[model samples]
Target: MIYNKRLILAHFWLAFALFGVAILLGEWQMFIRSPLHGWLRNADLYYRSVTAHGTVMGYVFPTLVAMGFGYFISEAALGQPLVGRRWAWAGYYMIIVGSVAAVVPVAMGLDSVLYTFYPPMIGNAFYYIGVVLVVVGSWVWVALMGINLYVWKRAHPGAPVPLAMFANVAGAYLWGWTAVGAALELLFQILPVALGFATTINAGLSRVLFSWTLHAIVYFWLMPAYIAFYTIVPRAIGGRLYSDSMARISFALFLVFAMPIGIHHLFADPEVGAGFKVVHSIFTAMVAVPTLLTVFTICASVEIAARLRGGKGLFGWVKALPWANPQMLALALSFVMLGFGGAGGLINMSYQLDSTIHNTQWVTGHFHLIFGGAIVIMYFALAYDLWPHLTGRALLNLRLVHWQLWLWFIGMIVLTFPWHYAGLLGMPRRMAFYDYTAPGMFAEGVSVVMSTIGGAMLVVSAALFLTVLIRNHSAARVDPEPFTFSRAVHEPVSLPWALNGLGLWLGLMIALTITNYGYPIVQLIMTPEGRVPPVFVGGKP
Candidate 1:
């Protein structure tokens, strides 16, 4: 099926362009905080850069990439032109304009609330509005995905939806519902206070609402990578998916389990009781099951491919596998990093262990590894794999792609490992300066130096990534095979509605969310005295 290549390329290029900018901002942030760069210390500038870096990387880049990738998969994997191309373009522009609107305030030092925008620390009203617009734009995508799937189902009757498109739409559905928490918080709580219509804002309540979106949003960013693992990587490596049913079950589990777990992030906060925290922590552990399933499934698929290539013993298949293939290498490295990240997450989810590292650099390292390291390496692989197909031009250099992936892997390890160590050694997060000259600060200085070096390596890797894309775009056109997804080992002839449909999962998510968050939120709403007046950073208000 022919896709609108221009549309796909436009979204992808914009996403990566922002990623390149965020990479530089991230390095600058680490540099200014280090002891050696004390002369460059400016708290205002550092926080602003941190806000912009986190916003771009956490919200803008991944969402755009997922949306763009979804559109491509809708057409390529499902063999149909997108049902709402005009709407998709509108969404693209909305995201671009919204990102600009949000970013301008941060750049001007008017809004440095950071990506989470925890209130009663408020920013300019436009920042909140800008974020709402981005979510609104994504909602457009969510609607379009549903429409396309509905239309496809009606057209093809009982035929099973393509697994890639099915999973993509499931992610869209999940985001549609999950984003409502943050959206409502902005509309009801943050916006009114930011605009000065309300003097007092409920900080605890805002945190609760944002938490609804926060943890689940990671799954939103992660789904595309998971989509690639189940649908694209297997085929790329000459293997079939181990189980279509397992893939469906994992995605379903994510939709149901990923949302209610956000309260685990609030274990340190006083607004919520221990009961709610324990409930959320248990759900947080539940979320890990799907990830484990994915790891096992993907590994099994790779093993099948390796065995076909002639492997004798139990682990000989690992050696026989295609180590040089960029996608294969990325998958292996992503899994390794994910293991490290997951172990840290286990600590965070434990009520007892969380206090040890809460608000420390350990939390920062864990998320960066999972989101920036494990998830984004797959994004890099996707770009390399898809660019040629979308542009009808061969990649300028495969060697450059390989080098970029390895550098990214190495850089992330160097960057995050020290953070984990230093976090244990009592390094606080979100601080602009570390005071290395102070008593008992020598060990912290060593970690800071290590982080700065890693940050530099990451910037180098980012440059190489952009170079590969630019060179690929300018390369001579060449014919390549149509991009295809792998079939499951046991092809799904007919799926139960529970497995194939979204309604059952969506209802369960709503019920679970209400059961978990309803009481605490209602309690806060009833008590006006609990609300606190806004405090504007940088003396703006």
Candidate 2:
């Protein structure tokens, strides 16, 4: 247990380092397009940094955190020791290797194809290998979750899966299915071709396969955050989950629908037919139903807690809610951020609006809202909650932790909102330096200024977070016992086997994917070897 906690903390430190690198790259990318280029004019450096930033933030750091959190939850949930501690350590080592391997190539200026790694835009062989390692490492995490679930079900035959374990296991199941597509691409296309095993790879097939992994990966990123919401939020807010069954329903729906919804990403692509895109787009909307339920249920739980605390009225609950409590503050901010971001997502998924905002700064803005605002805020809350427990000492300064959350929330909105407008104005994305050097660049000067100001604020927010984390580490000398979570609500003695079993959700996911993607993929397989790839240029940015 001691070793695992240390291992988890080590990953947290790596995550912090990766966060710094990711944000620094983001700042530099902004500089690349800045009126004052500020040493960011090198296009290759810009691309490499952007790729590293995206991969590190999107995959590396988040996976580490998720794996660490999963390790802790598995023991708690199953009430059994990890089946093989050696296996867990092996997974950890593989992750470390994968993270370093991926970063080294980017740092050395070898490949900067960005996270998607679409063929024809290929990078150095090591880059692909690095990515494969990361994916493989995550597979280990998934495998562990599977084993945990299997063992729990066998040992406690009639018992419902613990809420925390159920959510994590659902996430694992979804990831396992969705990742297969990307895994196929990496193995057959990117890795082989990058290593000189193939002369030319099918970019279309690669992308089509990658599209399978795209949107579903967001849910994978979000599952742990959701787990925290269902398990931690109620306790922190002095309430109970309104419905464990509702959470089960939500996870089941996400597993079934989220995996196959990636086609919406290809809405503008040509190789994939419009019919498939529509199906996926409709699937996209279906996802909103579960999310809406979650939003309402979570808020309702908070309200109930607030009312019990002597608050009055619909609006009064807001004030009664502990705004200073890091968990409560993060959850509130996450909701607001999701509202704005989720609306942008709906716009993107809309066939009409997608035409206008496709590949624009609006797309970037939307993801930042969802990924950074919603997911990252929960990370902050989790870190804050876990820091004292992990360190066996009280947080160095709870007020600073609260302040950091607010700063991060404010900074994110300020940073992303203007990007949305910029997208609408047809400002391109992923470029190093816009013709900002050209004469009359002053036309969009106001937007640029606002964006730069927002970027600066984000930098400040990042600094504040690091400060709090560092302070907590320094205060770890108190040597208090590791704190454990107690149940926040009474759980029923039994759950329906449908809620307990993996088979039903897995079957539903397969059905949805076939309904949505079977024809598209089959058509591609039958098409001639040489066709103008499925790529589409939807406007410059």
Candidate 3:
């Protein structure tokens, strides 16, 4: 039986529940922004919903899921019960309480500063405190993962750490440091102002500090999905991993490159220097290397699966692979989205091309495609794979799973493609509503309406996804096979210290971050002119 079943189930359930709510709110955002009728057609209510939706999805949902999944990995990969079981439970409750603390203020319309650190627009102090609690809870998980790995290594002496656990640890460390920038901004900066201990806030410094976090945090969210691609998909499709070492290198690269490169997000802001922006843009492109490596490795892994199924010649193996299987289908659909998302990302990361779509709907479309489309689809696949093991009840409806993934894929495309087009047409993002009746707005209006239909499909898909899981809860119990991950074709019996652990990579990440961010942040801090008096969103800042 899978270890710590109740805790695992709790994590997945909360994650999906929050996901469902966020999905509904997202649809509403799309509706209000479109020409369609919305129940609450108020701008304040729209921004409130946006704030809540972004906060839940960006912080609470992914962190909880990753923590839960990490706990599962500790047992499934390391063959030990969680080292800090009580701490695990404590962290769980911390997140629950934190989620409520953070979101309640948003619900009451006291905090509408949409998710990211939109400084100069401080909200209720509780909102900032709530998010910190959630991050601290995840840090507990990070500590536990590190402890488990250390304990296992001591006992085993020289064995290569399991690939799943190693990558999990990398992600845990990635998050540990990644949260620091935002944490600093909150505890030392935002909260003080939020509580009226300070009159002005360093809005520019806040953005720079948050830049240390925003991009890397997405990778932390992507870790579980990437881990599944490396460790789960091939096995589910009946093949071994392509290269164990390549997988390690890719993950290690992710650890090194992902954290220090988010300044590219601030390219348009005059407060950031051109040289720093260019350097960050270059490193931002470097982040793509790991994904490229992942695509190659996973494709090779899938090809082996197809070839083993007796497929001949060049592309015939694709036909031989199992499309009906949920994991395989999800992987296929995920790559399709990734291909499109990655193309847009190239434009986003470019020094020159970025200006054309800097604050436009293109940014919105690009992120949603990457996070909501490519990443979240894998989350669904990963959950589906684990459900039978977690609940000891099989998913009885494969057809529903297929349709749900297909709907998400279609909806994401229909939704994002138009936004990309409208961005090119010079439409701005992050606004509650636009003047659809104005000249030259026909295309943008039409695009919003189209994407709203797409958002509706996504809403239905989220509902159907929850239905599939909830149905499994009530299904009859069975002797589900014990959990295991895919093996590499050439699994290493022994490995170097760096590949087997996160220490070297963690040090490298910190050094690189210091190099990239140290001067700019110091400059921002030293320059008193960058400080802007706090502008309260729903109240006095």
Against the true structure, candidate 3 reaches a TM-score of: 0.98
Off by over 4 Å in 1: 39-41
**lDDT: worst 10-residue window of model 1:** 34-43
Pick by lDDT: which candidate is best?
Answer: 3
Error of 2 at 200 (Å): 2.0
**What overall lDDT goes with each candidate model?**
0.89, 0.78, 0.91
lDDT for model 1, please.
0.89
What is the lDDT ranking, best to worst? 3, 1, 2
What's the TM-score of each model vs. the native?
A: 0.98, 0.93, 0.98
- Residue 147 in model 3: shift from native, Å? 0.5
Q: Which candidate would rank higher by lDDT, 1 or 3?
A: 3
Model 2 scores what on Cα lDDT?
Answer: 0.78
The segments of candidate 3 whose C-alpha lies over 4 angstroms from its true place after superposition are 38-41
C-alpha lDDT of residue 250 in model 2: 91
Candidate achieving higher lDDT, 2 or 3: 3
